[model samples]
Target: MIGAFCGSFDPLTLGHVDIIERASRLVDTLYVFVAVNSEKRSMYSLDQRLAWLEAACAGLPNVRCAVQNGLVVDACRKAGARVLFRGIRNGQDCAYEQNMAFMNGYLDPDVETVCLFTKPEYDLYSSSNVRELVKYHQDVAKFVPACVLKTLLEQEEMDENIN
Candidate 1:
């Protein structure tokens, strides 16, 4: 089955990569969907996030990244995906994702949502938290892939200047 993972992925953290990798193995094809939330201010632009995602998942031939604005179920339909892949870190995340799954079901019952519990090591890391750490110049090499870290480092000066 074709599967889709949808998220902002502002900086494409390793935790996100882990989910993509595992999900890629479970389905014939995996689409990494990045929502273009116009109301949300992101550390990285949609293009940067998509590029980072592409770079991070370069090793996985079945994984593809796309940016779109609208309901995730619509994106899933466009990709011809039959499953929506999600990662849950805790009860809170589970509850949130469950609600989303329910809504997705309402949108299209043909697609199913599969939530994976986060690996303990990655449970505490998220794009927002990692972005906060980066803003303070804390080492984030451990939280993201080498390519993502490189982009962060390369754009560090620009970020500082903007701030």
Candidate 2:
């Protein structure tokens, strides 16, 4: 089965990797869709984010990456993916994802959304936290995967040089 994992992936944290790895085990193919919403601004550009994601998921055969600049459900359907993989970190995440899941169901009944709870070790890591650390120019290597960290650090250095 083809699955769609949609998120801002501002910096692609370990939590996102955890979900993708888990979903890859359950599905035949998993497409990591980086959400590029104009209204919900992101710290990194879509090109940068997708590059980070692609590098992070390099070795995973079942996992591929792409960028979608519109509604997630629409993108999922357009991609011919019937399952949506959502990673839940806690109650707060569940509450928010639940609404989105219901709304996605309402919009496309055929596209099923499944929630995968985060691995205990990654429960505290989130994209927002990574973004905060990046904004302050703090070391975020420990929070995200190596590939993501590498890209972020390189980008930061480039930005610093530009400044």
Candidate 3:
């Protein structure tokens, strides 16, 4: 069974990696779909996000990274994925993902959404929070994966150099 895990992933967090690793084990192939949302402003570019995702999944042979510009269900359809993976951190996430799952099922009955709970250690980590911490010159090494942290630090140095 092929699974699709879709997210903006402006900066891939450790929580996201955990879900991807777990999801990869359950399916023959897991597509890490990076969503492109034009309305939302991202700290990292699409290319950067893809790179981070690739790095995060480098060791997982069954995981592949790709970009999606439209509905996640459409991406799943294109990838021939029957399962959609979602990582839920709290009740808020669960509620929002449940609605999305319902709508996705409506759009494609063949695709099923699977919600995975994040580990307690990673439940508090979010891309937005990590970005904010970086903005304030705070340490975020624990929140994000090493590859992401390295790229973020490099980007910060570049920004400092430009200024």
Candidate 4:
């Protein structure tokens, strides 16, 4: 059955990619959902996030990606997904994800939520940290995927030239 990993994906980090790689192997098809959250503004636009994800997931046959707005359960249903996958890097992350999973279950009983543990190297990494590093002119090569790094660098250069 198809499964989906849904998140804001402000910028696709190595951690998110790790989750996608593992989740893809567990299901017939993996849909990467870039869900929009209105309450919190994102560093990058939805279009940019989607582009980065497309580049990061290139050549993955079963991995499909799209921007999802509205209820996550609706995104799962629209994608014909049987599972809503999340990545947990530690106990704190696990607790948060578990609560989300439970709420999603309450919303849609037909879809199951699964959490995959992140690799040790990416355990403490996050897109917010990556953005902070980029803002401080620090190398975030270790935190984000190559595609994201490339785009980030290019955008940074553009901003510099603009200034």
Alpha carbon lDDT of each predicted model: 0.90, 0.88, 0.93, 0.89
Residue pairs that clash (backbone atoms under 3 angstroms), model 3? none
lDDT of 4 by residue, 82-107 (tens): 89989988899888988988899999
lDDT of 3 by residue, 30-139 (tens): 99999987777988888999999998899999999999978999999999999999999999999999999999999999999999999999999998898889889888
Judging by lDDT against the true structure, name the best candidate.
Answer: 3
- Regions of candidate 1 where Cα sits further than 4 Å from its true position: 157-163
| Model 4 regions lying over 4 Å from their true place | none
User: What's the residue-level lDDT of 57 in candidate 4?
Assistant: 91
| Tens-digit per-residue lDDT, 11-58, candidate 2 | 789889889988988889999999976666788888888998898888
* Least well predicted 10-residue stretch by lDDT in candidate 2: 36-45
lDDT pick, better of 2 and 3: 3
Off by over 4 Å in 2: 159-163
lDDT of 4: 0.89
- What lDDT score goes with residue 112 in model 2? 97
Order of quality (lDDT): 3, 1, 4, 2
TM-score comparison, 1 vs 2, better candidate: 1
Question: For each candidate, what TM-score against the reference?
Answer: 0.93, 0.92, 0.96, 0.96
